[model samples]
Target: MRPRFITLEGVDGAGKSTHLGFIRATLLTLGIDACFTREPGGTRLGERLRELLLAVETEVSLETETLLMFAARQQHLAEVIRPALVAGRWVVSDRFTDATFAYQGGGRGVANARIAVLEDWVQQGLQPDLTLLFDVPTEVAAQRMAATRELDRFEREEGDFHRRVRAAYLARAADNPRFYVLDSTRSIADIQSDIAQRLAQLAEQP
Candidate 1:
C-alpha cells in the first residue's frame, strides 16, 4: 500500500502521548518509513504558536485561539506533513484538524461552519487516511489530569468542557469510516498490542 496519513486524537489525559511513541516505534520495527509529528508544534513557527496556545497566563479570544491553531496547522502541513507524504513516507500526527473541531467547536461553542471554512482554506481538503481515537471516560481523564503537575489552558477547563470534547470526538468517529476508537482505560501493554495489530492490518491492505 502507498504511504498513508495517520492521526491520533483524544481529549487531554487520554494517553495519546504514550501511544504515539509506541505507534512510531512499531512502524519502525515494521520497516515502514514514517514521519511522526504533532499538531501545533511540528515546525519552529508551530512550536512557538503551541506555547502561546497552551500558556495558562495568556488570555486569547475564542476566535483568536481557533485561528492561531489553524495558522500553526497550515505551517505544519506546508513544512512537514505534506512533504513527508509526498516523499512516500507515512505521516503519523499526534493530532490534526479533528482536534480543532472538538476543542473549539464542541468545548468552546464555536460554530462548526466557521471551523469548516477555515479547514477548507488551510487544509485544502487534505485529511488523514486513518485516525486512532483514544477513548477514555471523562471522569477517568479528570483523575489523570489531576495527577499531573501542571495543567495547560485547555486542561484547566471544567468537567463539562471535557465532556463535550469527548462527545464531539466520538460523534466524529461514528460518522467516519477511517476512525478506529481504542479504549484508553485498558492496560498500556494491551492497548499497544491492539494498536500494533491495527497497524499490521493497515500494512496488509492493498
Candidate 2:
C-alpha cells in the first residue's frame, strides 16, 4: 500500500495531545511504519517559526501571521513530510492545513478563498488521507487549558474566538469525507475506543 497521510486537528485544549500517544502505539501494533510530527515545527526552520508564532510577546499582523504559517509549512513539507512519505513511511501530523483554515480564516477573519490559494500553491494536491478532529465546547477547552500548561498566544484568545475556530473545523469535516469528528467531551476510554476503530479501518485501506 502507498503510505497514508493522517492529521489530527482541533481547537486548543481539545485533547489532541492527550490522545497522540495512543494513536502512535496503535499504529505501531498494526505494523505501520509511521512518521509522526507536528505542524509549524517539523523542520528546523519551521520550529523557529513556531516559537515566533506561539510567543505571546511577539507581534504580527494577521496577514503576516498567515503567510509565516504557510512559509513554515512549505519548509516542513519539503524537508520532512514529503520525504518521509516517499520513503514508505505513513505520515501523521498533529496539525496541518485545516488548522490555518480554523485559526487564521475562521478566528482571525482571513477569507477561506485566500487560504485556499496558498494551500493549492504550497501543497499542490497533497492532503491528509484521514483527519481526526477532536471537537469540544469552548468552555470545556478553556477549563482543560487552565488546569494544564501555560497558554500560548493563540490559546490566550477569548471564548468566542475558539467557538469560531471550532465551527470552521466542523465546516471542513462536513464537506470532506476524510475528516472524522470526535466528540471530546466524552471520557477518554470512549474516545479512544472510537479512534481505535477508525484507525483499524484506515489500516485496512490501500
Best by lDDT: 2
Quick one: best TM-score, which candidate? 2
lDDT of 2 by residue, 77-188 (tens): 9999999989989999999999999999999999999999999999999999999999999999999999998999999998889999999999999999999999999999
* Stretches > 4 Å off in candidate 2: none
lDDT of 1 by residue, 1-206 (tens): 58899999999999999877788889988889799899889999999999999999989999999999999999999999989988899999999999999999999999999999999999898999899999999899989988975899999999999999999999999999999999999999999998999999898887
Quote the lDDT for 193 in model 1. Answer: 90
Clashing pairs in 1: none
